[model samples]
Target: MKKYFLIIVIFVVISLLGFSIIPKNPFYNINWSIMSALIIGLAMLAFFWNFEKQGVSSKEVALIATMTTLAAVSRVPFAIIMSFQPMTFIVMITGYVFGVQTGFMVGALAALVSNFFLGQGPWTPWQMFCWGMAGVISALLGNKKKEFAFTKFIILAACWGFIHGWTMNLWHWVSFVFPLTLKTFLATYIASFPFDTLHSLGNVIFSLLFGKTFYTILQRFKNKIIVVPLDNNADIV
Candidate 1:
């Protein structure tokens, strides 16, 4: 835990460094936040490997790399604000696959790494916290399936996305620009609510399309690691 904490600290420092240099407003920020995460994330990952690259299995390395790449690439359209892609999908998947801690870590780290292109803003930390919560929430929702296969899980992931967006908007309204206020806030929820709905919808659609494939992929390596149990507690398996 201390090690992850240190990584988060480094993540924050890099984020602050980039954020300090950028102009206010999301428009001018770019993805500095994600970029900072890349540097800190790599450094922290290297640090975890003791800068030696020994003992760590190639598969474990591959899993993290795959998750990071998927998360990063999935977010590109979001940065351009061109579509309603829920980056939360990957985050929820991480948590559902590996448990709460891994899920939260991936979500936060992915956002941090992706910040490289988005430009770090005052909202960086909060965004991390918000996305991180999405994973944690998935863990709490457990593996209960109201339907067959992954229908219930997909619903949970979708709901989590809605929750993520609504929470972020509220955060924005309060902390509109870091040291935020109710007055300075744009109160854009009216405008952004549709985006939130789209995000949730996208999560369900995308998860339905890709989750089973990821599940199959995970099964190939399931025995090697401690797989998270989405079992009797749920209606679906």
Candidate 2:
């Protein structure tokens, strides 16, 4: 637990340091976004390792890996449409099914891996953060035994769309805008509103149609993975 706490501390410290240094001389040349992303990714990996120590089964690991891969690959089909992808929906579903930790991993990894095909830059880390947080938020709202509400899912998806756009725009605001005035920040967000809306709508559509399906699938996998103890005398018999 201490190690996990330390990893979180390191992630936060590195993020603040990276952002603080990005616009300054001697550090301006460094890709702070990439650096931050790597740092956070490493921290998440540490958390995942901790999860193993806490008895995360092999099947759970496999499930998360498979889900992350699917989330990344799901973006390929919507490559032409900017920000119109099922990745967010998939990540949220994972969160809803598996809870916050798994959701975050799926979300962060999806962005990192998908960028290999989509291309990575300063935006990669922001994408990871936004998507990862989105999953965490979704899991927070999810119920363990009941089906997640479709209406709530749509609302959350829409909210995350705006959140993602605003967060991504922050990168531009930080990297390009001098002094980082609110006016410039607002301008960037306003300009990207249409794209954000489309992304939100895409999320709503995907969630409405496929969210429950994904959850059901995950539940089945969870059921299969449950360690059913054998009767003590059964083997002897």
Off by over 4 Å in 1: 1-62, 142-149, 177-188, 226-237
Per-residue lDDT over 106-125 for candidate 2, one digit per residue giving the tens place of the 0 to 100 score = 89889889999989986776
Q: Provide C-alpha RMSD values for all models, in order.
A: 10.0, 4.5
* lDDT against true structure, model 1: 0.64
Strongest candidate by TM-score: 2
My TM-score estimates for the predictions, one after another, are 0.61, 0.79
TM-score of 1: 0.61
Ten contiguous residues with the weakest lDDT in model 1: 45-54
CA lDDT scores, all candidates in order: 0.64, 0.79
